[model samples]
Target chain A: MSDRQLADWRNHALNLESEVNKVVVGQQTPIRLITTSIFARGHVLLEGDVGVGKTTLLRAFTRGIGGGYQRIEGTIDLMPNDLVYHTYLGEDGKPHVSAGPLLMSGENLSVFFFNEINRARPQVHSLLLRVMAERSLSAFNSEHYFPHMIVFADRNQVEKEETFEIPSAARDRFMMEIPIVVPNDDAIMEALVFDTKFHNVDALVNTVQPDVLQFDQLNAFSNVIQSSVEASDTLKKYALNLWKATKAPLDYGVKVSGVDMNRLVLSGASPRGMSMMLRAARVNAWLNERTAVLPEDIHAVFHSTVAHRLVFSPVYEMRRTEIAREMLQGIVNAVAAP
Target chain B: MKTMIRIFYLLLGLNVAPQTAFAIDSQNLPDVPPGIVTIRTIDPVKLVGYTVGDIIEREVILTIKAPYKLIETSLPITGYEKRYKGQVIGIELKSVSHTKKENKDSATFDIKLAYQIFTNNVVAKNAALGPEYLNLINTKDSKDLVKYRIPNLDIAISPIAIFGQVKIENNMSPLRGPLLLSNVKENKWLKVSIGFLALSLLGLLYILGQRAWLPRMGGTFAKTHRKLRKLPQSPEGLKLGVAAVHESLNTTASMSVFSNNLGIFLAQKPNFSPMATELQQFFSLSRQVYFEPNAAHGLGTNPQQWLQSFVRRCRDCERGLTPETSTQKSGS
Candidate 1:
């Protein structure tokens, strides 16, 4: 891409970042990850406490980029077809069929946010993962396509009963599993509490000018940025070492407190996850107007991009979030930065 | 006011004026002895042999009858200029020594006289102890203080040799050395500095051990791990190990962390972030072992061994030594 086009793309990303920041007070990390994921042509899985503005951030994200926004709340009885098609009775006393939210937006779908995705049955996950993998769905007579879609999903973490977990295969589809944390700063918390506009998520999202980014250019720009951002051989070695550290943390001297090095990792970042990290890092470098991928760029996206893909020992599964944060941190810190 | 001032001036005048005095007639003292008492020079004066700065010596003896106290009035007072008759002798009386000896009939008193002369310009002349008399009084009512005189002892007064002819040395006489003093002393500052140095050494040792700057022997976590490791491979041993790791983490973070609050606890100590995964596993194993013992054995992980390593990591985090650093050191 030309320097001018790169600059324009960076401005659009910054605009969207700020536009989401407008509604989601003190959510800079989630906003940045979402923006990076958007530019990388990858999906994001947001996890946080209820009322942390995960949905609202995605809404503002869609509004900022001027793309079709579709939300589906996952439930125990939700079927795979429920996301693809809906059946209802009309005034004519005859059944009518219509495209579901996923198909309604078709090729213009930019953000298909799945709320409480864990509550959805494994069947729904299989369907969603397939479509997320292919960006298209097979209907009765034709194929419903969403070539520009980025599936943004969130799972309920508070309750565990009656929830069907998104299996590991489905989880690997996401580019990042970013946690939306509550703002700890008292001033931000007070503003979020006392500011009336911040309470109106719909209005806050409406203030954003739609279609600030050309979603159609997102794929091409992602490819160009990934190729243009030069990562040195040393950087590749560093990234490779990081990958090795995750799989067998003991081999690369990755040690987490309260865990054994030899038995800590059941598995590590897969090849797809590693490449996805590179892609995200490239987009990050492009956003920062850097022609080369810096170590800090990789480090910036490392935990979110690569942490979720790590599978810890079964005994440590419950601590995945923490281990993910820490083990990934250990890998990055253990591996030498180029 | 004028009249009062005049009266005050008249009183002041009266107070300042001199007045005439009455006199008392004194008669002859009653003699306790029939004969008069006289003081005579025991030895002739040697005035010619002494020069200026030399003392003139004289021996005087006085005898009186029994029960009569002789009062000698003619003795020269100390610091007074030496005089013979009416002439100043250019000498001063330096000292006087008196002695009394009891005899069977009368008490005899002996006196020694000394004088210092100032001038050496005098030619040979006659000097005297002069005529001295004593008063013998028996009654208090009698007239007293009668005159007594020391008799004159004829001597030739002479001057010293000419000043230039007498040679003088330029330096003073040889002097003695000063008294020896002890050298033994206490150094409070040195002692105090040594004390502080000892304390500083102890502080350095403590810091080195705490930071593991040097190789540390078994500390709290190490000892706990050892204790757990020594326990038999029983369910009780596994449970103990889990509890030990849990306690170590709680102590490190200063809070108890459940499976869910691992993030919260790790947040408190980012240094322990590396151990978050292990802590989670420990918590999960603990839950399995404590709450569902039946399912714990099949969980595949040996809870005891996992706890041992996890506890050690907590110790590492507490020491600010990342496992990678440890592994690097070990690898090296």
Candidate 2:
């Protein structure tokens, strides 16, 4: 694409963000990250409390993209085949088979939201991982492709009982794991509590303009964005150092209080994880209207892209959210950029 | 002969009165041969109020017949302590001098004596100059000799102060010691010490000063400017130069500072706040050089020169000085 065309698309992307911003109050960062993930052709994992507007934020984004939307509720008994097809009784009392939510959308699927994903069984997670990783599924003697689909899943970190934790390999397939929280702004909190406009979720989600971005062209524009945003040797080295720091934080002088540096990281971000990080950073640069990726671009997506991929020692896994935050901050602080 | 000797002594006293004002009467000379030592006179002037370190002068004169000449060896010597009743007193003869005049009938001798008081007394006491015995030998017969005795002169020797209350204003005398001591060398050393202290303080100020006028306080940005100046205009050189500046900003802020947090760095170090726009441009230039090397340089014909000037402005800000060209915009 020409520079002018790229600039126009960048404006459209920013417009999508503002459209979502209209509905979701005080979540500019997560909205921007989700927008970047859409442009990068990667899936996102949204984690927050039960009612911080996680689902609303994704719905608002899905409304803006506008191709096909599918929603699923993760339950304890949800099985792998439930995402593909289900059997129902016909009106004449005979059995009938119907394609499930995942296969019903087919190739037109643009946004797939799995709410409270941790509530699902590990077997369901294993099947969802294949769909997220390859954007395709093998079921019912056919291959199904969601070439335009971008999964946005949310799970509250408040509950532990009867919850099947997503394995590291499944988590690594996600490009970012962004956290949504209650807006600390007193005015926003008051609005959320008392404003009649915010009291209705469906009405609030309808406020965001639909079809602000072309879902069909997103994959192609992502390729253009990744190619146009140049990463010089110095930036590449900086990214490489960031990768090494995630692996061996002690070598980079990264220290987390009361955590042993030597045993903190059981495994670091994989090669695919690093590549996805670069992909997201390039999209961030494109969103910011830059022709080259700077260290700040990497920093904008560093924790979200790499933090989830880090497999911690089981001893420290209970405090993963807090420790991972401090560890990533330490890595960026300890490593210098050119 | 004794009466004639007495009359001659009176005549000699009359002659000595015109030559010396301190002449005193010499009477009742004992054990003196008649007509041999006919005339003699002694003067003890101002005999009262003598204290330690005070000098007393006595003048003596004698006329002896021609056959008997006064023996010079019998005169008192300097540093001779006087004795009273076989005990040595503190009074010592500090100096003595004599002159002789020869005449047809007899030889006249004039003698002067100075005695210094070395005694310490709590109260005023009577002190005296002890008498001296002089012998005259006859020239016609070496064995013939005569003795003449000079009477003692009694005087009062006082202490440095009286036993009662002494008032300085009333007792102001010309004989008092000086009040102020000599301090010429001490004054010279004090001036030198003050000069050295002032110089040391100035040196300390220079080392710890926040201004660029001082050598050591040129600061982090100044050092970075120097590093940039030495680099070439090549692509690698520009990259290295930008890294050097990034390093300096990080060191100044004590953390990594990118374009986004430049405001926080400025807020923490407000001296650099004036160059905020320029610093932002520099970060843009840094991004271009490090991340978009193939991209055209935005900083005019000579990027290295522009970088040098930009770093100089940053150096000025580091020194708490407002750069003259701070208003000038970077081409980037």
Candidate 3:
């Protein structure tokens, strides 16, 4: 595509972002990152405390994309088959199989939201991993397709009981872990409660055109965006250094205040995580209408993109996030700019 | 954290020091002895008339051609009289010599001896205290003795004595040969050959494992083969096809307009999607066939006719939308 077409496509994406903004307020960072993840054709993991608008953000983003959206509440009893079909005795007193939310969306599914995903059992997580990785699912001995789908999962942080944490392999399948914090700004909070228009999510989401972009064309568009976005050596180096630092923080001069640097690292981000970081960064840069990546782009998405990928030493179990954040900052400071 | 770090270092240091010290101490020990030879022999000779506790004297002479010193010596005996028969009968070593170029040498030994014999259907005991001597002399002609013997050297003497109230026995037979030797040689080459055979078998197994026999036996090979068979023959074409499918599912323009727009987009973004060309073609065809109004006007129809024809085409397309076929086409 020409530069003008690229610009127009980016503008169109921004317009979709604005449409989502109408329904969900004060989550611009997450909203933008989510949009980037969508264009990258990658899954996302949302982590936050309770009542942080994660669901609302995901719902609004799905509406902005204008395709079939399916949401499944993750529970301890949720099974792999539940994502495919519900088996029960109907009013006719006969056992029947009906399509679940995942299949109900059919081939047109563009967005899949899994809420409180950690509450789901590992068997369910494994099934979700397959769908997210292959964009297809096996149900009743047949492959169910979702060519344009992007999986958005939210994990609850408050409770540990009966919750099965998603394994590293499954977490790596997601391109980013966007943290949805409660907006600290009193004005945004006040506007969220007092604004009657914001209260009606359905009405607000309906403002965008339905099926604005064809679901099938997304891959092509993503390709165009990816190929067009160039990353400078300096920014690429910064990202790589950050990834290395996650694995070996001491080498990058990252000092976790109360943790032993030598013993604090169990495993670093896997190769998959580094690749996902670059993918997400490229899309983020593309959305900014920049042909090339900047250090600022890496900085903007570094924490959410990389923090959860780090595996801390068991000794630092209680301070994982804090140590990870410190290590990331140290990496940014230590890596020399070009 | 500081305490933890200190403790971690302390544990590591402690764990490493003992092994290091042990290794150093082991290295300081002396090397093991090697190449010392040992020789042992058993000589069986008749003691025709000897009694228990008798003081018997004997001597043995050995010829020497070179100078050598005797370090140490031992004599082992078996087969005694009475209850001690087939056990240690006697042992006697008199003396050793260091000599140079000597043709003959001799030494004397003393021991107590006894014998039992039968005569006229009555058991009898015999005892003696005389001397039987051997003289070693260097000679060219000597029929009754070895060629190297020294004259007038009383090297061997046997003295026998008996003490007990017992009848004398005669004509007792002496024990025969089959005296066991103390030294036995080990066949190292045989052991080495067996080890080599075992090592060769292990090497063969390693080669087989490297060739993936183990994985094949575990069924991973068959699974991988099945996965590979699903892949598209032309990767580039398949990727393009997938990209085209993505585009078709996403776009809303008429068939001609969409194709034209896609063509324009492809021209501008030549390397777009990196998916196979067949996939691209399939995607473009699906988009054009499913979403757009057919351009029958160029051939002979209006927009309404185009719409109806498009609807019919869409129905046909829907019928063809099998997940199996799609997965097969994608080779996934």
Top model by TM-score, which number?
A: 2
The candidate, 1 or 3, that scores higher on DockQ is 1
Give the CA lDDT, 0 to 100, for residue A32 in model 3.
Answer: 90
lDDT of 3 by residue, A1-338 (tens): 99888887788788878877767778888889888888888889998999777887877777667789999999999998889888899899999999998899899999989999999999999989999989998877898999989999999877888899777778888888988887889998998889887777677667655654566788899988778777654456657777777888788667878778899888888888787777777888788655666555666677777778787767786676677778776675555333
Give per-residue CA lDDT, model 2, range B135-202, as digits (tens).
Answer: 76678887665667766788888677776787656644444444568899999999999999999998
What TM-score does chain A of each model score against the native chain A?
0.97, 0.99, 0.94
Error of 3 at B46 (Å): 99
Residue A145 of model 3 has an lDDT of 90
* Alpha-carbon local distance difference test for all models: 0.73, 0.85, 0.59
| Candidate number with greatest lDDT | 2
| CAPRI-style docking class of model 2 based on DockQ | acceptable
Per-model TM-score versus the true fold: 0.53, 0.70, 0.49
What tens-digit string does per-residue lDDT give for candidate 3 at B1-332?
Answer: 99999999999999999998643221133221221111121222443333233333333333222222121122112232222234322322222232223234322232222222211112323322212122222233232121121112111212343334443342323322344565434456778888999989965564333233532222322222233334454533333333333333232211111222345444443333232243244433332223222211131222223222232222223222211112122221
DockQ, per-model, please? 0.01, 0.45, 0.00
Write model 2 residue lDDT over A1-338, tens digit each, in one string: 99998989989989998888878899999999999999999999999998899988999999999999998999999998898898999998999999898988889999989999999999989888889988999888889999999998988888988788989999998999999999999999998889998879999899988899999999999999999899988889999999998999999888999999999999999999999999999999888877888889999999999999999999999999999999998888777887
Native contact fraction (fnat) of model 2? 0.68
lDDT by residue (B1-332, candidate 1, tens digit) is 99999999998887666442212212233333436455577573334445668776788777765555655443456777756556787677788778888687677889888767665663434454433344555435354444345665554545565434343242111231244565444466778889999989965564334333445434556557667868888887886676666566555555434554567777888978887656656655664555333323333545555555566666666656674332211111
